[model samples]
Target chain A: MKSFGSIRRNFAPWKDPAAKPYIEFRNVTKIFGDFTAVDNLSLNIYEREFFALLGASGCGKSTLLRMLAGFEEPTSGAILLDGQDLRGIPPYRRPVNMMFQSYALFPHMTVEANIAFGLKQDGMPKPDIEARVKEMLKLVRLEQFAKRKPHQLSGGQRQRVALARSVAKRPKVLLLDEPLGALDKKLREATQFELMDLQQDLGLTFVVVTHDQEEAMTMADRIAIMDKGQVMQVATPAEVYEAPSSRFVADFVGNVNMLEGEVASRDENRVVITGASGAQITVEHSGDVQPGTHVAFAIRPEKIKVSSKQPVGTGANAMQGEVWDLAYLGDMTVYHIKLDDGQVVKASSLNSARIHDDPLTWSDRAWISFTPDAGVVLTR
Target chain B: MQGKLSRFNIVSLVFGFAFLYLPIVLLVIYSFNASRLVTVWGGFSTRWYVSLFSNQQLIDAAWVTFRIAVISATVATVLGTMAALALTRYTRFRGRFLFSGMVFAPLVMPEVITGLSLLLLFVAIGLDRGMFTVTLAHVTFSMCFVAVVVQSRLLSFDRSLEEAAMDLGATPTRTFFHVTLPVIMPAIVSGWMLAFTLSLDDLVIASFTSGPGATTLPMRIYSQVRLGVTPEINAVCTLLIAFVTVGVLTAAIVNKRRDLQRQRDEHAALRG
Candidate 1:
């Protein structure tokens, strides 16, 4: 079996100065009445990049996608596609297609007609339209159900038909808005991998907008975490997970334990923080901050180690606490420990063995320890 | 207790149907009576039908009514569909409330008041009262009914389908014709049928609007009824009822077949 983790992924087009961006949103600002949907946002997307706009609801991620799809025009600024201005062009004239969140299949038409609709709109020859429709049906594994209406098909099948119809004309870019949102959990998981593989196979630039953080993490090569119509951070999934630039990004993407602290002192290579609990935490790296400046120390729950005994290690930061709560998940165990000063911190460990030799219960005295490099410091 | 409830339900069903259909059934049966006296029982005969065919005045009135119904229904359908689209799609336009009010007000307006107002308007305008005037009145009233029907169906329409069509490179006009029209076709057809039947059955508006040489079937039948009830009138009524029944049954069967086919296809897909 092949393991994706063992292989290094190459994402170099974004860093190459000579490569021109395929799509550019230059200072795009969209306003509906008095509400600012997308604030002066500028972004660059390269060709064949699977980019995801990740945000909570009403965070303007979908507004950005709609602007690209030409359903909406920015109140100010311009969008450029292949170095040409995309202003004043309607959605039908654009070289991009979108799969709607509702699937939006024509209830009156059969699947074959729905997929062929775009090709017919393009004034393609009849023979070519037929062949292309057949090919799209095969691509989505829906060849046997071409005569069925959208209502007759299952949700997953209808989703595939929407996908095929959106891609029937082989658009330069495919924009998906909450693509698997209507499917069951098991089907959604399967479709996520299938979508990733499809994007890779077609080498098409895909811009997906989703509120699901895990879906964005699983499928996108690069993700832009958005909040209040602004990009907080844009990086690879691993970078966003390991080195989030802000406390919001850290908290949005996954679970994290935040320790409020003030910088006690700064050395040439390391900074010592005095937590609100009065525990001294020494970090290996120092930020450009003055001494006594307030900051937040964040660490993932998986990175913290919990032991019943006073742990002996390579000078790791340790906190004394009692187990306040414990949840025994089938694959992992989460322990919430409360310090003497009444601060709760969470730590999780994988259940590698079928049976544990020892288990920590509620009210058990424990020590939570982590290395200096396991946590990140955020000023915002 | 269940048996008693079921018996009560059966009784009510029978009573309801009898109350509704008994008069029409009697009228149809009496149309075929051989005797001239309506109250007398007579053997079944086709003499009334033959007399109806030979009655040139009644036939002329029927012909005029048919023409008005056909012309008015077509024009009403077009105008009503446009009104429905405007009201639903242009949500933020000025005077929308007034427009919707006018569209719906005629549905509940007293027919005598509507007829009197229309008659006064025609006289004020100095337009000749004839078939043209009757058709205009019919169109005016029937258009409202068609608009109400189409509007109800349009309210439940999925607007995203039109967006999808446009997203798939179809122009707005093409999207309406190819997607919107086909999906809402059932409502439009039923609306047209309603307008047609309403026009055919109208008496007061036609009477208020008609001039010489434009007497409709109902006007002629009313004059004859004022004098005396005739078997010929019954025969004509039976014919009209037959036409309406055929139209309604065809529509119902077509809708049923479509629904059944959809259900079957869904079942097959589930099994697969």
Candidate 2:
């Protein structure tokens, strides 16, 4: 937790998008004895982007970050930062910094001293180091606790101090290792916004590693979902959640009601599939297959429309389901409906604009419907 | 952190304390007996205590033991700390397994075996059996104890503190002294204390390695006890126990105080 909390300010002296990528992992692989931590990973991160490496524990996201920070030497593959290969670079010598999940601030040093550490390492003048330390304290809003040791500070405060310390050095790329995993739920939510604001203001390239889907979805510009030492999907959070490229990404992101469907017809933009309930449904995505191909169509729970009775003139994509379970989440209600074919579909309806006569409830016969574009047909 | 206990536990705890301390209590009581023979106690007298203060040979042996303990303890602490750091901080190396085995070999091997081996080693190296050789042998095993104690402390430690210091601009060496060393100072001090105690209590190794003029207090006491159980030896044992008890109590008190402070901090963190 002490190794993360770094922000990389715009540092190349000149801004040129046509140039090379900020940080590149060119076919990197890490092996510890017989256990392989990371496979041949090749990834390119642009400048000023909030990229997330999303995965479960031991999926090589941490290993990749360690390689970038010069903690682990890649067994094969070259890691490059700012056009130079990080072949012999040690952690302390690297221009990149990491914020550990543990918020690894020095317990003996005050907040200011902790922040001033990297600056002093670079042999900056005392006055300049002081000024920068003050600025970092103000940025993290710990000006009052500048003299406070890490143990004297709260977890959230220590997190900010680590962040401040990391930013004080102002490296080219900042690596965050489960940055928000240590905070309480409420503080984590609030700090997510603060971090986004800080990142936007600094316009730094940030690579955050986390297992928390909510945190990654709320913050990252693009996320590379990893599984078993490989990247499963690399896309924006919206695209990843709304249109997962695979079954793994779909299940990993959020709750989705997957229906077993057979391809019945196809168009350039749309494919019609006959579901297990003998209902025709249309889904939109790239790639096309012939009729009778086994395809899986996924729809998020909130995208489904539920009503007590079927409308007279319905187009397509309609099924009758009996309410199996209801989870009222205050702001919205999630309904788990079991279709006639025994396929369970989940739907969520908001409590916004309060209406008393809603027909969706426990043990109620309901017609669940969705638009053609509501669900995405996962390829592979 | 709470030590959960019930009435039965308290009772058993009292019983356990009696079982452990009953022997020491009897020993202390017999140390005060003024009888010429150990089986009979004629009366309580201060002759043994007076004899201990006046015996120059015993005093010289005690001085030699003290010197050996101080030097060996200091050497063991420094070297043992480096060994601990090498084992814990660095990734596995080719010789790591061998080094670890050698360091901890003393704890499991027989004392007589260790004493005999060191005697052969010193003789082969053309080293005379004296305080120097005794210090070397004492340090070799005492360092093992120091390394284990220090290594446990390092295990419970958070390594990020060192990385943070290094990130702040300190070299790896500087970070060790300025940040890492200060944090682990309590463990290091305790390791040194443990090593010192081991060296001070050592008799077999010192006896095997001693030369013409370097008879340690333990060696002298062993010879005296073989001849007969003298109150003089009891007086010395009593003094050694007193010194050791005071030293151990001071260390435990200091550790407990730090533990309480750490608990308070954790409580405050939880509150926040």
Q: Assign candidate 2 its CAPRI class.
A: acceptable
Model 2, CA-based lDDT: 0.84
- Enumerate residue pairs that collide in model 1: none
For residue A1, what is the lDDT in candidate 1? 53
DockQ of 1: 0.72
lDDT of each: 0.91, 0.84
DockQ of each: 0.72, 0.42
Clash number by candidate, in order: 0, 15
Off by over 4 Å in 2: A1-19, A144-147, A285-287, A312-316, B1-54, B88-91, B95-99, B160-171, B224-235, B269-272
**Per-prediction TM-score, chain B alone:** 0.95, 0.90
Best model number under lDDT:
1
